[model samples]
Target: MSLHCPSPATMPPADLPAPAPHTPIEDLQALITGCLFVALSILMLRESRLLTGGTTGLSFLIHYLSGWRLGLVMFLVNLPFYAFGLAALGKRFTFKTFCAVGTLSLFTELIPGLVHFDRLDPVFAAVMGGLLAGIGILILMRHGASLGGSGVLAIYLQKTRGWRAGSVQMSVDVLILSLGLLVISPGEVGLSILSAAALNLVIGINHRPDRYFGF
Candidate 1:
């Protein structure tokens, strides 16, 4: 007797349907990962006395001026954008974004106790922090959420006008970084621009609509 096994050419075709958007469990995992990375990025920026772009950068500016808690400032700064998010993006998207923002706020506050940095190079911090933040935001975007603030506007414009979210974000970021000249030194502002460029490069390259299929 001879035994027969199916060879690759004889097997069924491997074509498969596109995957459905993330389930709740997967979304939760993404949220956790995104928040942790963002928190770490913020910590690196803080340690290095650097700032990136967007509303988070505004929070940093406020924190520097007022000596308030960065996490709290960031959370409050993001609150006003929820209305726009709800109106333009819908209830589900806005709700998920709210949760993501809250998680990030809490994580930023708690991370200091969990992680410590004895020494960090400013240039290294700027580049790494920007990259991590860009990746974290990408995760949030893929999971149907955002970090709020200008992110809401970016998504809204993308959906309504076909503008790229990353490009929109980069424009806003450059404006915010320009404002940094009032508070931070010109050299620091230059570093912030570099960091923002790195962050936006990630978004521009990877966050395009054609690149990702998930909601």
Candidate 2:
């Protein structure tokens, strides 16, 4: 995401904003697929004894420390962020994000009962998990939705203050992943960094504001 969005009124006649809203069916499908991908990424990270960043990473940290269900914790951890999302991103985005977060929680809880991995490679898990999470987030962002927390803030900054969403996201990830060290080993933290890099790389290269027009 880039920082220099020209408002329709201020833009030249040839550069006016032209955002085509998503259809209900398209949004529903995207919400489902995006949440499912993030859920699967969480599963991979959990099984491989790793964590990434953002609210998901925070949820993992709490889950590791509290022996709580990751899905439930994730849902709860995202609660307060809804207020900021509603204020900054608008009602439609907030509503979609609420549903997306809830769906992700449900999927994370249910997927384990349906799938299992006896031996997951850590390196593969880190890369694939990051990629999956990145793709999921990209889908949501394109549809005027986010996973809440820093995702919302990232988008808001891009839309209003002209900050790069990818850069803002990575900065937050660095902080959250640093805290992961308290709960995980140094090596696991390194993998977590790799995952964040892969995840943000997708966002940095593909989700630029110059390319993204949906609102």
Candidate 3:
């Protein structure tokens, strides 16, 4: 008896296989992650008198300058990105992201009044805020959902050209943070940068590829 491997001629066509479908549990996890992302974002923003990076950060910047509701600004800023995400990512990802964004917007508007963090010390605020936001972002990532800022572009570039998501995110984050120079004082800019670093730090340490695949 001889052991033989199938030749290329006998191999199954790649196109004939269907993509694996996500289960209900996966969807529930995504929704829970989205809720956490929103809650943490609002908590961070309110606690630190600071902003998150990416489009949510931009929304805060706009709110600071214009007195508009932060949630409204977030929703508006993210609108254009939805189409971009749909094209670059996929329907499931895009839909989850959209839901995440909406939930975040609603929470941003509702959480401030419901939960107060007015007395948190600035240093503690920054550190805790970053930690919470980092964990929340990690959840979104695990579920194939994004908050729709630099994240969208990061995934797009990663897929198209085999770029690392972290590098792309860092580049976009740097650019977005630079905008703070024009809107916020230099000292606040420094704090924002620190908070941003903390967010990435958690992501870097806790979300290693080997450990991130499961819930």
The CA lDDT of each predicted structure is: 0.77, 0.80, 0.68
Per-residue error (Å), model 2, residue 49: 1.4
**What overall lDDT, based on C-alpha atoms, would model 1 receive against the true structure?**
0.77
- What are the per-model numbers of colliding residue pairs? 0, 1, 0
Model 1: how far is 8 from its true place, Å?
36
TM-score of 3: 0.79
Q: Pick the candidate with the highest lDDT.
A: 2
- Per-residue CA lDDT of model 2 for 1-215, tens digit only, reads 11111223322245675555679999999999988888898999999879878888889999999999999999999898787677666797789889988999999999999889988999999999989988888887777677887766776777789898768877877788899889999999999889878887877677665554554
Model 1 segments more than 4 A misplaced: 1-16, 154-168
What is the lDDT, from 0 to 100, of the residue 125 in candidate 1? 82
The 10 consecutive residues of candidate 2 with the worst lDDT sum are 1-10
Candidate 3 ranges beyond 4 A from true positions = 1-26, 158-165
Sort the candidates on lDDT, descending order.
2, 1, 3
Rank by TM-score, highest first: 2, 1, 3
